[model samples]
Target: MTSTPSSTHFLTIKNTFISTKNHIHTSLNTPLHAPNSPIWTASEIAESVHGKLLKWGPPGTICTDTRALQPNTNQWFFAITGQHFDAHDFISPQLYGKGCVGVIGNRVCEGWDNGFVQVEGNGNVNTVDSLINMASYARNKRFNGVLVGVTGSVGKSTTKSMIALALESLGVNVFKSYGNWNNRVGVALSLIGMDRNVDIAVLEMGMSGKGEILELARMVRPEIRVVLNVGASHLENLGSLEEVAMAKSEIFREAKLGDICVFNADDPLVSTLPVPHGVRKVFFGRRMGCDVRLVAAETADGGLGVRVVLEKEKEMVKFVIPSPGLHLALDACAAAAVATLFGLSLAQVGKSFSKFVPVHMRSELQVARNGIKIVNDAYNANPLSTRAAIDLLQSIACDGNRVAILGDMLELGSIEIESHEKILSHCCDSNIDLVGLAGNRFLIAAKNMNLNRVKNIVHANDAKILAQKIVKRLKFNDVVLVKGSRAMQMEKVVDAIKAMSIHIPP
Candidate 1:
């Protein structure tokens, strides 16, 4: 998928399961670092955090998943703010007689005689800050590794996963984020959740504000930074496109002279950025100027067919991605670009691409019963990404009818309508056979479109209302494209379509 340079961001945390164990401490003692310790050093934890010590002797164990927050079994329950129900409320009641380490909040609580790590702070912000501090401290003590930060408006998560999986396949012990845990708390928590033996650390830095990316970047101090194409996204928060570019470019700003900044050569905004003093930069894309360029690409049923001819090198080899779209091709190029720096051969990198698959809900293809094709690009929405999705939909349209069920793209700020209108214009080009528009603002743009010229255009105020109508309207050989900003919850449309029980592609 195409990523914008604009501000909205997401993080990743791999499934690094921390082995839950019985209680480890009973009373306070000078903290000591252990090679296999999951808890941070006392000094390291104190250095980056500020919180009231509710109770700290020995945290039985750290419980990250809320549903799995079983403190009675021996674990420290940390409640820092109002973001969650007070951990103290459940601590005493749930583990009244249990051997659990309690990490309760500063708020009111009744039961607490011993085993409570209470912290007083400005509710949400301070508690999380300190918790993250603890996570960072744990990471420092835990892993002796290289930190790789991936950011951009799009494809950060997928790129991070591809590299991590490839590294893992090569027998490299790696620690990457799980899901979209790219935020401050997520990053901190992921660090705490990290396994001690990880040889490489991959973190996705998703940002919406000015210093957010910087915060993660500082924590990572990556040996290498990958800036996927920057486009317009989260414009509401970052304010302008330039600011979005600057925000993402902060990676280069923070990178040391010897560190490499991998960029998208096809992206004008990213490619044109004046490289800051000291940091080395390399470009990857379809452009001739790119250090690593896609010489040619073909298409096949199993995957996307590609023939990449690296510039200034004699290597020209064919590769096939498990996923479709030129976007995936670009992602492979970016992965190949970074893999080279990691001492991987071009052939080895090509082999890695051979096993790649689209992260779920990101242009993943599924065929419903009755031969209807569904392209699920529902993970996110942005002006550039939406356009790219539409283009992909258009290219995939064949004997089947092409349909686009869209919702409002969020965080576009003042230009939401114009952005929506631009996509509408693309639909008007006739690649789309039917158009279902949800959201009031989206409806306005649909109404303004040349509806009569298009074969079919329906405006639904909400997804369910529109989904019910489309369920009856969709026919055999129809290709439906469901896309929208995360706020729109457009995945509901994908679900509604799936609920129809059409023959699905395996």
Candidate 2:
């Protein structure tokens, strides 16, 4: 009988599943330690949940999401009580059977036979806390492979993807935390359901507080920790920009004797970290003293630039990164430096850099038939990345009227207003002729900057209104940059622009 490679190691298994008149097994040959697909014992599930909860609390019923839950569809889910919704509402009747475990819920939920846990107050708070603890627990077990933890005000996801790609290209069975799964809950999910086949797991850890990184660091115990340039993304929650740096640096706190620390040489905060002696330290950027330096950069026909850089062994080699922002260039350098320590050659590393693509809403490029250029960089925003985007927009040349469509950056604790003001000042300094800003903070900052007096500047409190207004104002060959935090949804503006007919430049 053919079995799954190993039921425990399969992220999603295929044809090895077997079904007979009397029995059904997802993997005919493999041992089923948990149970059938979409069903598990209440006790078994509680054991998993216990790993997160740290207490021997009885589990409630197990319910899989209807979308992913199907006959022979190999997955199950546990619902824990939180401050918000109760798991009781979503339970279906088909879950209870001969092999059925218990239902997971806060109180005695109907259509459930297995178990229930009584949460006294604020279920969501407890649920999230328990989940965080469980995530920490699961990651600490059998941590054999090197765990690379990467975080930055920006580029953490992209950098982690590059590390994973470079490693996988070298025949390493790499497991990477998917998308923006950098928070505590996301990290927990990655580790809990990790496939045993993963040779190296690249994790992205993001924090908005003083001790959050330490918590993640303790969980992963990374052998190689990469802290990308820390900037003021969540300044409000994090108190100050310096505090943000400290929080990001906490990734290095749990490094062992032989761990490696990778950092951006150009970012002063990241470069100045007091790394431990036995652990290796590597730096990458355009700075002269850095171990890796971008020797030359020339913007090509498209917004993307052909950049040449010097690595540890390679002196200078030109490569085309499909991005215009210098920040992205620095991210590529950082990824290269990281891959080098992982035993990848310069060619292998450099080749993977080209293969690296930007995630959506982070400086994505689009051109109209009539030659209007738009830089869509509205994924996530902080002051530093905003400035970087502005710099790229300002480089549109002596002829093109560089336009910046900006939105307010969220989660900047108390310094929100001042930070927005600073961004307005940077836009002015960059000589952007036309500026359109959205959200209350940006509107206030724009007014404070006296942008109303500047004939070219326009401020709108809402993003949709601003996008429509700016679409009408854009001219041919005008380079417009659409950027803000994801919450701002500045992509709508890019959409509005595309919706209009292009006006050809004379």
Candidate 3:
């Protein structure tokens, strides 16, 4: 049976991973982050992203869109084409004068010697693979840093930040992913653009369908891989929970014999995946047998205070998560597991946890212009995460009504109706005083279900209309929660409330 490595002592501060093969040796005075010393020559990058050097020039920054191209900046261009749009159309001989060092693509449009790197693969997959390869090359050859990959249906960005904070608290220089930059393009850019002096790089891997995580895993080749949980997220593309679990498990594809795999053992789906023979398994959850277990979570100082148990050290760790909700606390617990693998004591990780803050527009408690508290969890949402946010809103002690402004949870596909119905039902049953809903799915759910059973509900066409409806009912000192899918743009409701008149419109 594979077990969690007791090698924590070996991964402390200043400890980093330095790949020996394909090692890049550059100027001592110039770091890889500095453009003066090219991290990769034209020939080197051609081989890196799996392209041919039809034309060659000095390397610069990487560009996928020409519109965002800065002239006279000496940047490289990637002319990616999709079914509706083609980025290659803007690439002309004049682009070089506009600061393009060269064009990286499969086509040789402006001629062979005009600084074009003939991309080897065809179609969108290959084009993206080429970028992934560039990230892979950078990870394998760049300055020393322990690479950490984070993935799950939710909590990726929050957990990624937590791990970085824990490491940084110990005086470890860390590189981390920002916002929701977990997709292919975002992940590639983050890895390639990292500061070369960091001790650790924490990245998030998000997938929309099958095989996406596997491809990202193949390229990232992280030393420590974190699988947070499997839920109803991306169900429209993946179809079922088992498929989501299977897809998430692909992150272990690059897990070599001794690599560390950290997972949420409390999840029925996540805890049951088949692990490769020799990889070390570290489990974090509220379950008793978990390697990193959550002992308790309670309300404290406008946030959540929790306790974690680290099995190896036989220590009980206590900390405060800067956000409310049990889900966010669990994410921080998972981060503690990852932090310990890097030789941080449970106490050390807990201290850092107390200082961690949620990303903007994500479970943040903000006081509006009229002193109303708004839970701005509008970053993105699914059935599971949306429900959690609802629970959070109900738990807070409110001076006035607890209002919930919710929009559609997108991409649920066939289960869209049922998902919205449950969320609406959850709101009605909770202590929430009023509810304002938007989106076709929620409307359908409200209409399909007996309105006699569901009360305190109002409907709107979209976020804008919902914002108007919510602001009209707004009261002084009321605690409101705004959340929905990314497409729903529920933040508009929060903004609308902030823009309200000094006194209630009544």
Candidate 4:
């Protein structure tokens, strides 16, 4: 008979039970941030991950990017092994020379002998599990803050930022998810270093396929879960819109009886998801009877003036987001719903939103000295967001031509051609004067479209060449909307436009 290893571990850390029988657990019966698990020491971190501490260093922070690694600090590096490249390969002698607290991973790089501590585990361990376990550790340990998980097909980064900024403006100690850091590793990283003084931890959760959000949600178990919308953002990986909806619905996996779940009532897909019994539902959008409903929205004073009414509170909140678009106003509604839950009044929520700025490369409104307006939305794009950007470009009071430098909406899988064609067609239907195109999909779609009715159009293999074309025809005060999928690097066009002198188009 195989004998069970005799191990009984009860870590009473700060009057919080951390581990029992080699397992860590959080009690829903216990209050939020009950201190069931306090901050972990170097030894505790090693023990939890089943890593052997060949050497010990002082407690430190965690870093993933090698370029950001600083010298002589208590920073532990999580060398993530990605698909195409191994981060361990980049861990150089110079990195050790600069000095860090330690490294965590199965790989033993060249600097192993360089006197820094290493938490290396056995069994083909490449640090992802340990990192995830640390994510769990983040969930269990420290501080008093409501962990809010945000997920959707688009606008996740903006929505996550909006919530954080609004709460922070109101003097809440907020810990926001770093820009677009929503993957499994990114999510873990956001939570693992959660400061104890934080009142709200707003984390963005992203996934490309099935089981991704569920896996992440199971680990963090956020108390407030916000599902914005479902669209064709990742149709290539997941197959269809229904499948995409299913993938996003996984964000609610860990939601329990007392948790709060938020959704966009106007979204056809996100509004209909099943909620666990006893969990509170907070809906936001233009739809009637929504907890937070968009009462009226319009361009006001160069920004967005949005009036939102909360049915349950029987109050109206008016706010101004430092950006334009009904979509962004809807995002504000989502943020307002979240703020209301934290005991913030409707008026306070409104005031806090006034400080919200668009994320860089998302919808940054920039004006050149010559009055050339650039809507730098080059971060990432899908069909839903592209339509909004198009509408916004047409609605802007432009004294000059409207040029839309559109890139390929990637990850659409089979519908790549259809999606691209529809966007080009939408541009044609609009008053956009010049429709600049990039990527093979758009090139193909441009060929398929009937050009007799379409406006002036140009094509380029990539962003660099496309910028040349636009600059040649570019005019002062011409409003340009630069947008593309993440892989397209369309910011190059925006940068090129800003750097190069725009020709006085003869």
lDDT of each: 0.66, 0.66, 0.76, 0.73
Q: TM-scores of all models?
A: 0.82, 0.79, 0.86, 0.87
Residue-by-residue lDDT tens digits, candidate 4, 233-269: 7888889999998899888765786677888888888
Q: Which tens-of-lDDT digit does each residue in 17-116 have in candidate 2?
A: 1111222112111112312212233344445455222123232223323333334333334455456655556655564432233333343445444344
Pairs clashing within candidate 4: none
Q: Is candidate 1 or candidate 3 better by TM-score?
A: 3
Residue 388, model 2, lDDT: 83
Better of 1 and 4 by lDDT: 4
Number of the candidate with higher lDDT, 1 or 3? 3
Error of 2 at 95 (Å): 8.4
Whole-structure CA lDDT of model 2: 0.66
Q: Which residue pairs show collisions in model 3? A: 72-98
Which predicted model would earn the best lDDT?
3
TM-score (C-alpha, index-matched) for candidate 4:
0.87
**Minimal lDDT window, size 10, model 3:** 23-32
Candidate 3: regions farther than 4 A off: 1-4, 7-40, 54-56, 66-72, 92-99, 106-115, 121-126, 302-312, 452-455, 504-506
Quickly count the clashes in candidate 2. 15
